[model samples]
Target: MPATPASDDLREGSGARALLRLATPVVASRLGIMAMGLVDTVVVGRYSSAELGYHALAWAVTGVVLTTGLGLLSGVQVMTSQAIGEGREADTGAILRRGLVYAGWIALAAALFLAVTGGPMLHAFGLSAGLADGATPVLQVQAVSLIPIIVADAGLFWLEAHGRAVPGMLAMWAANVVNLIVNLWLVPGGNFLGVDGAVASGWATFASRLFLLVLLAWIILSWRRARELGVLTPAPRAPHAAQAMRRVGYGAAASYFIESLAFSAMAIFAGWISITAVAVWAVVINVAAVVFMVPLGLSVATSVLVGRAYGARDQVGMLQSAGQGFAFTTAVLLAVSVGVWLFPEGIAAAYSRDAVVIAGIASAMILSSLFFVADGLQVVAAQSLRARSDIVAPTATHLFSYVVVMMPLAWWLGVRQGGGVDGLIWAIVIASTLSAVLLWGRFAWLARRPLVPLAQPRAA
Candidate 1:
């Protein structure tokens, strides 16, 4: 079937219902992404707190690269959605092909960069020799997995853009099963492979990512509309289309890189405090990340709606989509914050039995809750802005809120003031609030201006 135009129902004040419908599976899929990491952190933590520290630090480094790569490929979703909204469904296959090629090069460069420089970079962080050495191997193993995950994300994003989120969600959960089984078999000492600790968990991540890539590839290839959508044929040359996709990705990549780098710096600060502090910081951040996926998913859904509306030249539809998205994000995050605040200890205990780590995590987790709503809202606002092609504003907002504001504050409060993990959480809370305010304001300002469809690349 050809792409349908944005329906009147969406413009008739049913946007909230539409947003929820699209967001549910997307949220579950996003949770699946975080669930894999949650399992890793829990398994590694249970195996040994010291090993958990290694795993945390390694992941902190890897996470920055992985998320940035994902951001670069975000155009796969945006372009695909815009094509559909413009009733150029066949053009989406070209978008996917370009995204896949982009994913491949990005994966290779990232993997090589990490393999070559990850270890020395760890050493330069002033971590103890033992900590740096212990994390090096794990980081290298994770580097290998980046290839599969990054490529898989491109396929996943394309499918999600086409409103086929369930397949990706199922594929991700299946991979999680693979990850869990391998982690259980290898993370404990005396395993058949003789591998344990963070290294073993790293292998599990690699296996799961490989599985995820293969599964998603199969799904895309076997999609019922593959031929009709031009997936089976070569995409014709279209420089403008490719350029448009990359242009959007450039801003998103910058935003994602800056934000992730700032957050990763918090882990470095935690390491400076104590090795145990790394474990505590990991647990707190992991929980916060899991919560973050909900908003991230909602953001994707919101962006899709906004992109579609922008394509159809429906300004009212765009505003309604964003309004519904913001309301839903706030409500969901508030509920989550309450749960985290009320039972921080119970949540912390799930990760590790280390008494000191648990205490530290519990306190920091409570403070972390304060930022959940703001953090969630900021991402939603940023994505919505991108969907409307107001990309630079979000990038600039994040640069200021996260890098310029949050990073130095984290260093001072968490390090100089000796507030440790809690201090870092405080910095995040302030930065997220500032980011949300700025992005929301940008969107509102743009809403007041004349509405124009983002220029559609001409077919050659």
Candidate 2:
């Protein structure tokens, strides 16, 4: 049958419908990733609250490194999407090849840094001896998982850029299933290894990460068109390829560090207040992170669409993608805001059974919902800007918002003014709002002008 124009628009698949198609499984993939932490928190929180605190602190440290490393490889997705738009699809294989090498180095360096410094870094934060003692082993075990996880991310990003998000989604959930099984077996204190509950959870995470890496790599290698996609051969030198990837990576990495480090510092500050404060803080942040997966998925999908448009110099398409991303993010956050505000207790209870922790988490979550909305906006805006090759402004905004604004406010409001966890959440709300406004404004201005490609052809 001949297709009508309306049917063609729907079937051709570009715009919000297309964006949603891409976002659904990507959101699932993001949620699957978040579920690992959620599972760990639930399992360990039930096993022992004290162990939960240790798990939280260890994760706080690890989260900074994990996010920053992911940021360092952000170029793989951006570049691959752009390559497709530019009719340079074959270059994507080289992008993947280079990205893998970069991922390996990043993973190795991160693992080594964490292994050597994680224990002392906890001590340096002036944590209670008990907290530090409990968290160090967990931290060390988590350090080992970084290698597998980061390398796996390189594959995930590569496949996702080619619009193959379902495979990554499946791999992520499969890893989560493995994570849950291992946590059940190991965190109950009856294991042959005799590991503590917190450390046992860490081992589960390490094993799952290893599984994820293997599964993703196998999927990439076994892809039916692997050679046609350039994965099976050496790439001809494109003078700008390596340089462009590194440039994008550095800016993104710095932006990631600014935000993650600021939050990690807040966790450390929570430690200074009381063991209970950090514990409650952990529960609050974990729940917020679970909700955040939706926007994170949107941001990734939006960036790909925008990058494709930018590569093809389709200004209209770029704006449409960005606008749609912001609209969807705002709508989702509004709904999430209502849920968090009305049922903070229910949300907090899912993580911890203790009355005091639940009360603290609920109170903090009420304030944190505002932060979540602003954070959702800012991340989507930042990714959209990066897709247009406007990277530095987002980095600068992150520095100002997270480092200059958030850090000081967190210290003063949270500690000196005695607002505790609630104060820290408020600080995040302010910083995220500032970042969102600034980044969106920048994207608006940049979109009005032309966007240059990340790489240009060398002299003929």
Stretches of model 2 off by over 4 angstroms after superposition = 1-11, 452-460
The CA root-mean-square deviation of candidate 1, after full C-alpha superposition on the true structure, stands at: 2.0
C-alpha positional error of residue 430 in candidate 2 after TM-score superposition, expressed in Å: 0.7
Q: Cα deviation of 210 in candidate 2 (Å)? A: 0.8
Please provide, for model 1 over 1-460, each residue's C-alpha lDDT reduced to its tens digit, 9 standing for 90 to 100.
3323323323344778778767888999999999999999999999899999999999999999999999999988998877777777777887898889999999999999999999999999999999999999999999999999999999999888887887999999999999999999889878876889999998899999999999999999998787777788788888888888988998999999999999999999999999888999999889989999999999999999999888778899899999999999999999999999999999989999989888988888888999999999999999999998888999999999999999999999999999888889999999999999999999998999878545754451
Instruction: For each candidate in the order shown, give its overall lDDT on alpha carbons.
Output: 0.90, 0.88
Report lDDT (Cα) of residue 285, candidate 1: 88
C-alpha TM-score for every candidate: 0.97, 0.95
lDDT per residue for candidate 2 within 418-438, as digits (tens), equals: 999988988998999999999
